[model samples]
Target: MGPTGTGKSDLGVALARELDGEVVNADSMQFYRGMDIGTAKLAPEERGGVAHHLLDVLEVTEEASVALYQEQARAAIDAVLARGRVPILVGGSGLYVRAALDRLEFPGTDPRARAEIEEDLARRGRSALLAELREVDPESAERVADDRRLVRALEVHRITGRPFTSFMPRREYVRPAVQIGLGGPRGALNERLARRVDRMVERGLPEEVARLDAVGLRRGRTASRALGYRQFLEVLDGLSTVEAAAEATTTATRRLAKRQVTWFSADPRVEWTDFREPPEEQLRRALRRIAEAG
Candidate 1:
């Protein structure tokens, strides 16, 4: 996986064509309908006749959690395998991607309690919520990186009525695929990200966001949280000029790319490729690795 606009979708498309495979989207944003451009979703012609699953499958009003994504993606991958072609999983959502390929098991949820916890979250942002979770479940907080994960921990604890620290016995998962990273030194990647932001604006990302609002995907839900969309929404609300929004998009995108770089660097399974490498070369190396696995 790579950062947004790091050519992940294009590489996935090219690789799917090369392998004669179906594309299963691992992107969290692309799952929402009417979010086409900002999520960098492939157009009909761009897909090159390859069947793409899990794109535009839900209304933007719907917010997908990792567990839901895993469930659907698993089904789609099985369908692709049944067709006797490779299933190419593509996107920058590391959590959904890894959850699908590695079969990680996040604990179950209790709906009523989840609602309560989410209410609590609204009242107190991640820090206070995390502090609360930490007081009750220090070990889980220690294991997970941040408060963004407190929601998951609280869900598990509230559902199971058990200490969140006791999740280790549930770590059984069978990995199904190889993972890799894309991009290079920070300076080079930032340049590429800026150019990508420019191109996205040129392609009318602002119009795309307005169209989503037309389709009643107006709320700042999960889909709207995709990089360029919300910035454009600010422009829609007259909170910022288009130029300001574009600059903010580029800045936010840079920070996201940096986080992605750090995430990939820490991931042992992800062999990386520099942005300078041709996509075909990266595809060839990946295919070779898969073949060797056989």
Candidate 2:
């Protein structure tokens, strides 16, 4: 897995075909049912007849929980293995990917505690919560950028009496696995992302957003905030033009790609291939790496 528009979907299909494997999605945004075009979700024909799990399992209004995703993704992988086929986990969501493959533990949440933190957040604001987090968990204070995450960190600290950072996934894999990362130069990726956003708009991202909005897209805490969907939703509200939304989506997607690159690059186990290389060469390198890993 790597950045958006880096051809991870095509690579996953090719690898699944070669290894007789099924694909398990680790992308958080792809979980929603009606978020197709904006998410660049592969159509059924594009999956190359490979069975895919954990896509379109949630409604637009449902909040995505990484803990639930971890359970479902591991079950999908286990089922693939039990059927005598390999499991190819593919997506750009770094934390979800780690939750699927790493030995990460998710602490249970306390709604009462969370509500109290939310109250504090509303009354004292993010800076005050951040200052409090610094006292108990400085690493999470430095890392968390939003109120939702900040509240969750404090809630976890209160309940578990452990730093939120303590729950971070270890580098150790829970099972035998191989990660193949595809990326190219920043300039090329930026151009690709712009082109991709343009294609999405051309393919009717606004209309897609309109349809989901009719079915409560804005009510979704997570799905509504997705890159292109968020921008296009502004178009539905007449707050922005399609052209402006496309531009915003491109900018946001480029930033997301940068973060994805940084996140995946930190993992030593990933064997990266240049997206500028020939598809055949990339596939060969990936297969060789998998063999070496075995």
Local accuracy of candidate 2 as per-residue lDDT tens digits, 8-59: 8889999999999999998899999989998889999999999999999999
Q: What C-alpha lDDT values do all the predictions have? A: 0.78, 0.93
What TM-score do all the candidates reach, one by one?
0.84, 0.89
Return the clash pairs for model 1, or none: none
TM-score of candidate 2 relative to the true fold:
0.89
Tens digits of per-residue lDDT, candidate 1, 1-294, equal: 877666777777877888889999988888887777667788989988888999988887787888888888899999998999988888887778777777366677677877888889888877787777778788887776754567878888877777676754222335457665677778887888788788888898889888887776656468777788878988989999888998999999898877777766766777676657787787887777768767
Cα error, residue 92 of model 2, in Å, equals 0.1
**Clashes per prediction?**
0, 0
TM-score top scorer: 2
